[model samples]
Target chain A: EAGVAQSPRYKIIEKRQSVAFWCNPISGHATLYWYQQILGQGPKLLIQFQNNGVVDDSQLPKDRFSAERLKGVDSTLKIQPAKLEDSAVYLCASSLGGVRGTSNYGYTFGSGTRLTVV
Target chain B: AQSVSQHNHHVILSEAASLELGCNYSYGGTVNLFWYVQYPGQHLQLLLKYFSGDPLVKGIKGFEAEFIKSKFSFNLRKPSVQWSDTAEYFCAVKAYNTDKLIFGTGTRLQVFP
Candidate 1:
């Protein structure tokens, strides 16, 4: 199976500038996720999509962070007016999203985009 | 609200050494657990998961995790580790009936030959 794919493996931008990261999940995956991993810290879930609709975004900083999955497939995460704290690895993941009995909570993650906010 | 905890920030071991990494979760509802590992310059991959019927779940590369409901813990273990085992391991949890995941700060294991 093709793993989740992310683009622009690295990015650099000045503070207050905006940037967007793209992701293409494995075929047939129904759930997609965006996560932020800071240096020396664990990955934090920012947003999740079930098909083309959002399933969760409670952890997303709506004021600056936004994400969208179009046509139930590819997705993008954007950070407007980026802050220094926004410099981190952005990971995209996809899952079968079936019942716990079926999928067994498995997830496939992309290599991630490393963003540096200067 | 739910969160995951990993006790070790980093671990170093020689070849053939035993390994154990602790992970705990705080959630009032039923939960699902997972352990993911990322080798250097690689994407995160699922090592194992625990849903039901088994307290001890075996995963790829001889890794295993025991889920103890009473302790709210799922600790990963391996009998003998190789230098190839060096990587960052993350423990994640999902509340039953939910689609989101909560991850713990990773534990970086560096195995030496």
Candidate 2:
């Protein structure tokens, strides 16, 4: 099976600029997640989608960050008026839902988009 | 709020040396534990997971982790590590009712051959 796919392996933008990252989850996966990993820090969950509907977005900075998983397959995360603190690796992952007693619940991650703010 | 902690920020070791990385989580409910490894310029990969059954779970590349419920810890270990084992390891926890995975700050390991 193919792994999760993300576009624009790297990106650079000035502060207050806008940027968007795209992700395509593994086929048949029903759950998708977006995480931001800062330097010297662990990855933090930004948003989660169960199929096309959002399951969680409590950590997402709605004022600047917005994400959507349309058609329950591809996802897009947009950061408008990006700030210096937004420079980090944006990772996308997929799973087969949280089904117990099964080995399909673990997530498969993408290479991630490394964003740099100038 | 649930959180994960990795006390070791960095570690250096010579080849064939035993390795241990500490990970602890603060959660009072049923949870799932996992260890993930990220090689240089690579995506995060699952090292091991402890959902239930045995407390000692073995993973790929000869890595293993012991889940101690009483201590709220899942420490990763390897009897003998190689230079190829150099990478960043992250510990994550997910509560039984939530799909969110709380991750700990990664521990970077540099193994010299």
Highest lDDT, which number?
2
Candidate 2's residue-wise lDDT over A33-63, tens digit each? 9999998899999999989989889999999
Error of 2 at A100 (Å): 8.9
List of clashing residue pairs for candidate 2: none
Clashing pairs for model 1 are none
| Error at B62, model 2, angstroms | 0.6
Instruction: Name the candidate that leads on TM-score.
Output: 2
Quantify all predictions' global Cα lDDT against the true fold: 0.92, 0.94
Model 1: CA > 4 A from native: A98-103
For B76-99, candidate 1 gives per-residue lDDT tens digits of: 999999999999999999887777
RMSD of each: 1.5, 1.4
Per-residue lDDT of model 1, residues A1-118, tens digit only = 6889999899999999999999999999989999999988889999989899998898899999999999999999999999999999999999888553354558889999999999
